[model samples]
Target chain A: MLPAHLRMLARLGNGEVTMQVDGPVTQRSILDALEAQYPMLRGTIRDHVTKQRRPFVRFFACEEDLSHEPPDAPLPEAVLSGTEPFMIVGAMAGG
Target chain B: MPGVRVLVGTRKGAFVLTSDSGRKQWEVSGPHFAGWEIYHMKGSPVAPNRLYVSQSSGWFGQLIQRSDDGGATWEPVGNAFVYDGVPGTHQWYDGTQHPWEFKRVWHIEPSLTDPDVVYAGAEDAALFRSDDGGLTWQELSGLRRHTTGPSWQPGAGGMCLHTIKLDASDPNRIFVAISAAGAFRTEDGGETWRPINRGLRSQGIPDEDAEVGHCVHSIAMHPARPDVLFMQKHWDVMRSDNAGELWHEVSGNLPSDFGFPIAVHAHEPNTVYVVPIKSDSEHFPPEGKLRVYRSRTGGDEWEALTTGLPQQDCYVNVLRDAMAVDSLDSCGIYFVTTGGQVYASPDGGDTWSAIVRDLPAVLSVEVQTLP
Candidate 1:
């Protein structure tokens, strides 16, 4: 699942994007695969140079906030096995 | 009918307003890239149909959009704006040395002779140029590495290189202005630059007549005489006769001179336009009135053009890049207010009418007179 703005920007239909992760699906691996699949989403989700997640963007899966997790940490088993969709969210913050 | 296309960048999205030569009966299109901040949209001087847009967001970062068929459709171009080399530090808001960081693009200036070449002015005050249309960009780097780079600080707004003027008579010469950093001129294309701020004065700075740190709001020049320039500083209206070598106060008879966005007439190089707000702190017209002041003799003397503008109980600001003029025989002047009003003067500021009301707080406006 993705934000409405990011969905429109990536031209994805009204559904979750499923990609084939080559190896163990960590946060870094999933993000690297997603960015490789959709090049335009590179800087939108993370900084171009520092590669840090943008301040107002969050990641969630299995009904838990995984935004603060280390990039090398393994995602929830449900997210890795495709039982639960990884969610990219725009934080409920400023206007 | 010779028509005009008015490209407007607003707080929420971008809008394109089209009209026939009469400048009446406009057709407005978009909220293109809806729910995004469109900072600026500009067309190529050689190929008017080729357009470039700066689409950015706090959460999603910066993206460049390009249009080939006059903004009917757009494609995302390059978004990477990596600073050159070490990306050194400049003065931060707290008067401490902070490393330069890329935030967003404030302006996009396409080359005069090529549709494939373009320039972008970015926040944190840097310049980038793209040669292969908009596919990639490289920083000029010399401007940021100037000797006075450490002393530059942000104005009320973030430190942004918001103005880029390419001299038509000499392709190698280009001029750019930054908030609180004053103006700079490059003689050998983008290789070498020097601060050209001799005669400008600002009260708040340590030295009133320092080389940099004047906080230039906007700058304008007529293509016919690129040597002469008009500037709307943070408080005063200024003019330079020798290609920005020395500036002099031209605030003369205006009720107030603290405003953004100054423009020159399309055909008459001697005529100029400025919207004077009350003061630096209060960014609105004086006496609760909205007026567009015109000077037929270039600078000192000015006349308030409020025939169709509101003369009472109006408090809205015209931002630094919101005013633009079209090159029609009759000469059309257009500007957008923070109140979401886009006003047009079809006959050279003699009278005015709102082209459209209730937009998303326009950030910039540019006009293209189409054949």
Candidate 2:
């Protein structure tokens, strides 16, 4: 889903593409970096005016849900180590 | 070589169909912003290559797109449409007060003289204008803040301001139409407004002919004769000769006037067009026929133009913004369906041909005649 959104930002379709976002890289910093690089994705994850996280979009890191957590909260070490992509997943509803 | 480019906005994406001056063969490109809803796309009348498209989606909200090289490439512009001051409230579906909300851009009309100046009509019924292309938009709040604002109610389509007509004869005069709220006109650009639904009759409403709430589907005025106007109301085809101060039923002999997208002939001020659906309950053509009725004498008499169009077993609905006219040596009429077929009539509305089929259920259609 992150790749799909990155593609929406016109940043994909290149071979061995690797995007680097510098510094502390908390959940909030990482998202801010991503949105900074892909301005079109600004409102796709949050709102344009309100900056509120869309109800259907969720965030996760270190095998834990961090969607409702504060923006400045630190992520688990595995995410920052590049072992897993701090996941941005679409929340599922209605079985 | 002179040619025509047909810009189509649909539920799933945007498309550009091109043809030479002959209006015969066609080359189609796109599904740009694929999987997104392209409510409307129109090219600058003066700078024909400059184009503006309203791209939106439920997952991503709204995004305005601009293209400088025709439709070859596009870049995202500003999508922020903040209403001026306290947005206030309108009549809700359950007859309660509901705050005005921004849904999406329904129509984009570029200025006739400038490429960067454009107007956008939005849902929850508001008008916005952008001078620096579509990067940033500011609401022309005088229309929304009018004294009658509270009483305005949403039609089945959620109270969208879908039509914006700038008076070519008078720069300060602008007209806009909102569903379930009738039509409004402003003489001082967009600072002040007045409702222009004097003679419309909607049998479904409580008072039938209230000052507002008429559900005006679309309105059209030939630039040569701006005083004389044509409208496709929710239930009747109407015409007014005195700048919308009053209107009279011109449904005349139309099989059914419960249709959208009324247009005027490019060359003939008195000639008009309307696609008559069966009724409010049945949006498709009458007796399953896809015929565009042309009224050469303005409004009264009508004749069905079906050449090359599906005559039977056809049931596609044309939206208010899905029809347009291209100014060429011979006027051309184009209209698309909810079923994804774009039909063209090079000789006005006498005959029709499907330029492209199985598109993404077109939401709007606009044409630019390239010189």
Candidate 3:
């Protein structure tokens, strides 16, 4: 799942997008695959140079906040197994 | 019939306003990129149908959008703005050295003769150029690497290179202005730059007459006479007679000299426009009157244009990039205010009317006179 704005930018019709990761399902691998599939989303979710998640962006999988997890850490088994969708969220700030 | 298309960048999104040569009725189509902040959008002079936009957000970062068929459709282009070599540091607000970081694009200037070449002025005070339209960008590091770079500090706003003026007469020359850093001129394209702030004086800085410490709010030049330039500094309205080699005060007879945007008449190089605010501390108009000061003699003497403009209880401010001029026979002038009103003066500055009464506090406005 992606934020409405990012989904609109990437021209995704559905809120949730499924991508094929070549290797183990980690945050870095999923993000790398996402960027490769949607070039327009580059630097939107993470910094181009630092690859750090933007301050106002969060990641969630299996109903748990995974934004603070290491980029290379493995995602939840539910997310890897496609039972649960990985979510990229725009934080609840700004009126 | 010839027509005009007004590109408006506001706090929330961008709006494109079109009107026939009569300049009476307008068709407003907008709120594109609905939730993002559109800093600036401008059409190319050579190819009026081609447009470039700086769409950014605090959460998602910067993105460049280009339109090949006017404002009908847009595609995201290059957003990466990596500085050249080792990005150095500049003086922060507290006088401590702060490392340079890419913030956002504040302005975009398309090539005068080519639709694909463009320039972007960015926050943290850097210039980037793209030759293949907006797909790729490369920093023109000469301006930020000046000898006085370390001493350059941000104004109340972050250190933003918010103005870029291309000389139509001489492609080799380009001018850019940064708040609290004064103005600079580049004669050898963007490879090298020199401070062109000779006669400017800013009391806020340690040296009132330093070469590169004056806070230049905005700068304007008439393409027919590129050597002559006009500036709206933090506190004074100024004019440069010889391509910014030197400048002098032209704030005579105005109720207040402090202003934001400055623009020149499309046909009359001698006519200039400025919207004076009360002071740097208070950005509203003087006496709650939203009037545009016009100087027919190129400055030193100004007249208050208030017909159709609010004269009482108005406190909205005009931003540095919110005023622009069109080259139609009547020479239309347009400006947007923080109160979310976009005003148009179809016949010079003699009269005015609001194109749109309510917008999201316009950030910038650009006009294209189409054939």
Candidate 4:
């Protein structure tokens, strides 16, 4: 299952988990595909102009926090092979 | 007219409160686009069903919501607001140069006769026009490119184009006011502009009657008399009879002239409305009494209308865009306060009732008198 931040796309998508990897399967490609389909989530995950990950949003997969990793970098074999779903998380702070 | 629909924009979301011609029994349907800052929502004067809503968030930026069938259902429109050409800088809070940024829309003025043509006023103080409905927008940069753009600064609120007044008689004439930057008029459509603040005296600025640095809170132009404009400045209510060419202070009998939101009656050209807050520092009704002052002969004489409002222990501030007037036969008045209250007066301003209570802080209120 994905984290709570990526789950907001379920309200607009066709109810599928969108686990299919078409080409290269990079983090940027997946988010671009998701934001391409659901325009409402455009700026929530990343800066609309800077294209940087939002300060509060993070990327996680295969028991590793990939938030600071490069967007075009490849993922672990578990995530690449669909054994684990890419997770978009809202980081906790200030509490 | 069949009924009235109040398109209310709040800090969280948008709301639609409808009532029959009586303006008594209302059915509230909202918070549409929940968990977003709805700065403004308005219906087209030509097509009442064509509604436009401005929704934004710090995370998601700005989005325009349009509903062809009134406020029943909505679809998201374009959110991108790109400044035209060289996108220069304005005076920042520290008296430094700050690049213009696209922020939430402050006002939406749809065309008088076209549902597809609408205008949006945005923060960073610029005007935008959408010709193909709201699906796309282009900046009318002449106003921002006026010679005095460098001297313009933001009010306590960001530098925002908060008011847009289009002349019904002359389609070419357009008037827009920005906080801390005074008022401007465009005679040849949107191609050229000039400051029309000749007699405004803002003590906060170095030159009290400077040409371009007055914080105009709100400006209202009666539809019948488009040339006559009424303004609620940072401290006083002013009037300009010759289409903003020259101005005079008409705040003779107001309790306190420091407040936001100035509205005009639907039928009475000489009748106007303003809620008198205590002072600039204290942004609430005087003596804890929420009174709406009405001037029958424009601005000198004032009478407080306080039959159905809170008398004491109430402190709700009214924002500049939170008041509106309907054009029914008897005329209807509506306003929402920062304390989460929406007050309505069906008989003009005689009596008031809280049609809505305990919502998020209201940002703007606009009414559509339907046939």
Candidate 5:
């Protein structure tokens, strides 16, 4: 079990969805929880085999772009402490 | 034949080019969608008069404009496909919250089997399909719906779907390349897709499975032999004969392996073409030389074609969709670089000539024969 007030930002199709997560989450745990909640989000975040980040999905916490951070890397203390929001943004471009 | 019509899509607008007798004289048309950025312009193969342009207006939103009168006038597909977001929800992508928000449509390809069916690859790593020409669209969420765990992270370009290749022989069999996810294939149309990144190479993975994150920029299939495919990967050029089941690097002979576009001669399936560029460190044409290489033996041997190109230092970046080979018997190979120059090789890349220069950054070029 985790804290009840931790918020997450899941960006999709040029829009962001901020949802509440109840746990101490690493990149892997956050995505696992997301997939369990929204089954449609299964393969949307990482590579199927290597479990590495896809080119388009970016994660951020407290103004920091955590996209390239390690999968199991610990989230910011503020994000874990339920004091700040973690954002997942979609990076869109025409070219 | 009157001449070849070149549809040029740019960062700003769309342009049309009509040539005279010897392919010497060219009349260039409008920067249609003037202030907007046109990422893709696809002329309907089934209907010569129909043209589709995908544009993104900074702070104005993204749109798919259709032109029935060639490149003269345009109209949007309506409000149905607009990104409105959930009602009353002040989400980040909420159009009402961020009034100027829109997703960029990076690539668009009309269905070979169904002319009205059009598919678009977006920056969000999602696929949108339009059944009635370019009127309305529906997101194919299946590609984003199957990841079971957390390892699925988006790469540098975001989780984007850059290229979509549908089999002309079997429209149901489709292939899509994601920037970091490698390549995916689907036999049952868009109902389901499977990652086919077995033999490619990526940056983060171990040497044994480096093929996973190879960052596939573009892929070309031998029209006659669908199983034979060529990929312009981030670090190397590779070929897969078993329809991506396995891949082997064939970029040894080229001066550099870092490039974006790859095209196979329409008539001669064994023949393919690639514009090589210096690696990430240099990131330019090899030794300041602008050349196109043709591999007639399926990457076994390559010949540099520079008949009428600049003889001196030439440093230009040719985008993936900027270079294409026509489907004619003799075949016409064309390429546009970031330097606003267009080159055409009518002799199957054996000889080259400049078609036009001093235009906007050439994002994409498609050649169509006019009746």
Candidate 6:
């Protein structure tokens, strides 16, 4: 049987985009894949050494707020099952 | 049809002006919220009766006032609206545990779709959100958690939430620009946020760390094309066709590249407006020229529109929220200056005329047309 694909929803300032990934993904793996695919997005999603989510960027999986969650934490089971979606949101405002 | 009403927020207070049919005669109102330094005043899009003003008093601290009777009477959102310092956290610059205690509210923007949802930016580099109509607010942890180290310093005025742009199509989608922290966006309300500062530039930073948290003063987005956006940085006017994924300099033709405000036409996505000021040294209109420039093709080309503006020495700096474009099909472009003058261009900035002058130092400007 083919592994489930997680639907990842990413929202930037101007618009929103969605992508799909096969397998139960951790935050680190997902970010790695994203950085590998879009080199311009490498330093954007997470910090280089700490691998922590950037200040203006937040992560959400299965409706749970994962902004402060550790990067290595396993995503929710619903996301693993491909029934739930993971979301990455951008911070709004300049102060 | 009733002409557009322009709300001018000034250092002393707030004022209102209504234009005549010919877009000539001006009826000006009081210095409402007088004696208080008005940082920003926004006329609610959902309810015309609601006008929100953010004020800062040196001895009293930051306050958000609401005027239901159209700037006639005002009341604070309650004592809960006050901005006290965070518990035990000290700011790096001044080493003050709570710099917000002495700070001012720079901008107050209420969500157009949800009038009850409001956001305020302060001088201490903090962003606060209120769901219950400004009665209370919670600090967005996402910004507080951002660690830029000691070198990620704020600009002259300090890190602040100067502007907040909500996706008209999706209320949950919001964009915010910070002075030294750069720009950020959130699509799922405030639960999570991402830095959309790609293609943006910092003064002397290398290519690697340039996009993360560069200073951004103002941002303008096309109503129809969410993917297209424009921003006024410290040194350049930039546009991103891919929603800030990458940005390119669009102020090539402008007289000056340094500016605080940028506005887009209500109906035309390709048409935009910005008031250019000289760079850090001069920080005034280019060669003392009081004119507003229009970009008809997304900043590809710009044309100076100065029909009635002063041709002589006119040193003025338009604040980030001082310039506005009306929602009418044949939009009316308006802007106020720090020199206490308001200029209006009825035919989409093709020509210009001064509506009011010598009132007070204008801080922010908002325009609304009553039915």
DockQ winner, 2 or 3: 3
Checking candidate 1 for backbone clashes, the offending pairs are B180-B215
User: Model 2 chain B — which ten-residue stretch has the worst lDDT?
Assistant: B55-64
What tens-digit string does per-residue lDDT give for candidate 2 at A1-95?
A: 27353365555563112356577767668877877766777776777666777777788766778899877777777777777667777566322
TM-score preference between candidates 2 and 5, better one: 2
List model 2 lDDT by residue over B329-356, tens digit each: 8999999999999999899987888998
Ranking by TM-score: 3, 1, 2, 4, 6, 5
* TM-scores, one per candidate: 0.99, 0.94, 0.99, 0.93, 0.73, 0.75
Report lDDT (Cα) of residue B367, candidate 2.
91
- List candidate 1 stretches off by more than 4 Å: none
Q: Candidate 4 lDDT, tens digit per residue, B181-202? A: 9999999878899999988888
Model 1 / residue B221 / CA error / Å: 0.4
Candidate 1, residues B87-173: lDDT per residue as tens digits? 899998888999999999999999999999999999999999999998899999999999999999988889999999999999999
Largest lDDT belongs to which candidate?
Answer: 3
Model 6 fnat?
A: 0.00
Best by DockQ: 3
User: Could you report the DockQ of all the candidates, in the order they appear?
Assistant: 0.82, 0.40, 0.86, 0.32, 0.02, 0.01
Poorest lDDT segment (10 consecutive residues) of candidate 5 chain A: A1-10
User: Candidate 1 chain B, which ten residues in sequence have the lowest lDDT sum?
Assistant: B200-209
The DockQ-derived docking category for candidate 5 is incorrect
lDDT of 3: 0.94
Question: What DockQ does model 6 achieve?
Answer: 0.01
True contacts kept of each: 0.69, 0.28, 0.72, 0.14, 0.00, 0.00
